[model samples]
Target: MSFRVGNAFSDPRVTMRQPQPVVLIRGTLNPAHVSAFYATAFPELASWLNLNRIPVSGPPVTLSHIASSTMMEVAAAYPVTVKVPTTQRITMGTLPGGPVASLIVQGSHEYLADGYDHLRAWLGENGYGPGPVSWASYIRLPDEHGDQRACVTELSWPIA
Candidate 1:
């Protein structure tokens, strides 16, 4: 079934963020197959991090190139406590940190795009435009062994 977003909520404050080290997995995937894509991608990232002895300092993040809807080059990233080396699909990079607008979403994964729509609308309303990229940080994910009724995500766009 096609997903539809309902209502969206945003934090009142938009802040400047500092650049931080992250390990990312980049690939192109269809929007409709994101769940399956992540299922295979995230674990490989997790294993790579574990094998490299890197500690996860923050939530999992997925960044997208905002230009296309059919197929997108997306990056799945995990913030690390310390800088690490680039290897294979996982690479060392910085998550874009600067002027950003964010929306906190709490719901099923299928509806997460609704949060992005809200954020985009809010950015345009406030005279902010997409700065080449946008990201969704999974504040809370479905359990490894089970699913949850709600998931918490922060949808953010770097803005001018």
Candidate 2:
């Protein structure tokens, strides 16, 4: 399917989201491995949930800690209906959602820095201050072994 490139909500707005629970795997990855990482991580998470009879609650979310041009420390997660026990490589936690500034970045994951910058700028322009954290929830991942240009990434920043 073709993905369009533009703002997530067209007109940016501050919205409140309820807390969500997720099953996540934290790891370090370079830009080159982003696609591969998600490709491998999601299915593995899904299989684990399926094996344990857990139900999915929301879309996949990638919580980035430090994303530089060289490396990124990220938590790949899928929201779950109930609390799930932690595994050797995976853990469960709640994403405390409150007021947020959000947008959509349609393209490769490598350009996400620009997207984040854009959100920060918007927050500043509108007199909204950023909170301690931010995250990217993937709406559409790139095709397996396909071009990254068609990817659709959603970015959200906690704001006050």
The C-alpha TM-scores of every prediction are 0.86, 0.75
* lDDT minimum window of 10 residues, candidate 1: 1-10
Cα error, residue 81 of model 1, in Å, equals 3.1
Q: Number of the top candidate by lDDT? A: 2
Q: How far is candidate 2 from the true structure (C-alpha RMSD, Å)?
A: 4.1
Off by over 4 Å in 2: 1-11, 28-40, 67-73
TM-score of 2: 0.75
Kindly report which residue pairs in candidate 2 clash with one another: none
- Candidate 1: tens digits of C-alpha lDDT, residues 49-156: 898788999999988874476887778899886878887767977877788787777666666676677778778888888777788889988777557446778887
